[model samples]
Target: MVPFSLTAAHGSIHASTKQVGCQPLASKGLNHTEQQAGEFRSSRRLVLLLGIASASSLQRPASATPYKEAENIQYGLSNGNIRPCPGGYNPNCVSTASLNDLYSPVWRSSLTSIATSAQVLDSAVMQSSDKAQIVIKRSMPNAEYLEYEVPGLFGRDFMEFLIKADKGAGGAGEENSEGAIVLYRSIAGNVKYLYPFQTAISDFGAQRKRLEAIRQTLGWRKLGCDLKECFE
Candidate 1:
């Protein structure tokens, strides 16, 4: 039962502490065209980094035993029924089951169906996990659940989603017009942000906050846009 930690792309998995950092490219002597090219390259590199964000941080022997489903943190399952963090658990996890304002509301997808929702979730999954570490634990026509080791304090999390055939917000199957209602949730194994004290930096309600970011990111992708353009 060894704990895992992500140290950005620098340290190994299960490192003492996990982290992620960004290093901006030096732009001192570049002319306008070169600087713009550099910025585009940076954005593309960031997209790749995010797709396999946890891979570079893992360090394990070839002989290490494989992880079993029984060892998974059962925050319910990856299906539509995932519940809130366990009683007395740390503040690191969030879910749609939570009525608390700290949790992000479920996301509505631009398209819905076994095919389309799967397309988006599939892309999200690759963006979130290392190929070697992710495991598809459950699957159904309208639902999917996966578990993987991330570079972090606990190094494991579950991502689940269910696609409703109905158009979003009580509308039916407007998968093209309004899309379907998609329920998505992710929960981490780090319940104790701090050993015994919950402070402002403990990442409390973080999962709650990422929803908007995810929405914005998806919008950008659909429009074939990148973050640099927004900033400029």
Candidate 2:
């Protein structure tokens, strides 16, 4: 290759015309002032790099809400969910049933069919080389329930989705609309924590984010589980 430029033995930069770079300060010794100036510029670049790295490290992280101790977590259709979506004794779970914004925002089904909803869920959970696996699925008269083993950074969560096909007229929140709603609840099934060293490694608000990921997969908007699905 042709030389873009060459340095003179006397002392000068060897670089492309577009930019000036490289110092032969060591190869050909320079005056004390010139050497100090070069050192100062190098030090400035180093400091700038370190400052950027420090800022990134200090940025606020996603707050994780942890359930330190194991609590009474209930599941299944027969196990008394008299009032579904209620906050349980444990903090590791997030539900469409809770009033807290941290847990209330529901994924809109957007007139998607119950069967299609199931398929979407199946697809979402099945995409990442089997990252999310359905462990159990059952269907009743108007609803379908599916349980999934969703893996997280620290552990896996046992997530359940109760997808209900509402007629919207006969007490489905409206007198003449029709749509579907999915009630989600997840518990830290096997959260790994190193005791006192890492006592809390439960739900770091991952439940909603997981659902949100599925929402994007299904192309659904955010809504309250109580609100009727109106978009076609």
- What lDDT would each prediction earn against the true structure? 0.48, 0.58
lDDT of 2: 0.58
**What are the per-residue Cα lDDT tens digits for candidate 1 across 82-141?**
565532444456665666643545554556454666567566656643542555545654
CA-only RMSD, every prediction? 27.8, 18.2
For model 1 the local lDDT of residue 43 reads 60
TM-score of each: 0.47, 0.53
What TM-score quantifies how close candidate 1 is to the native fold?
Answer: 0.47
Q: List the residue pairs that clash in candidate 2.
A: none
State the displacement of the C-alpha of residue 134, model 2, in Å, after optimal TM-score superposition. Answer: 1.1
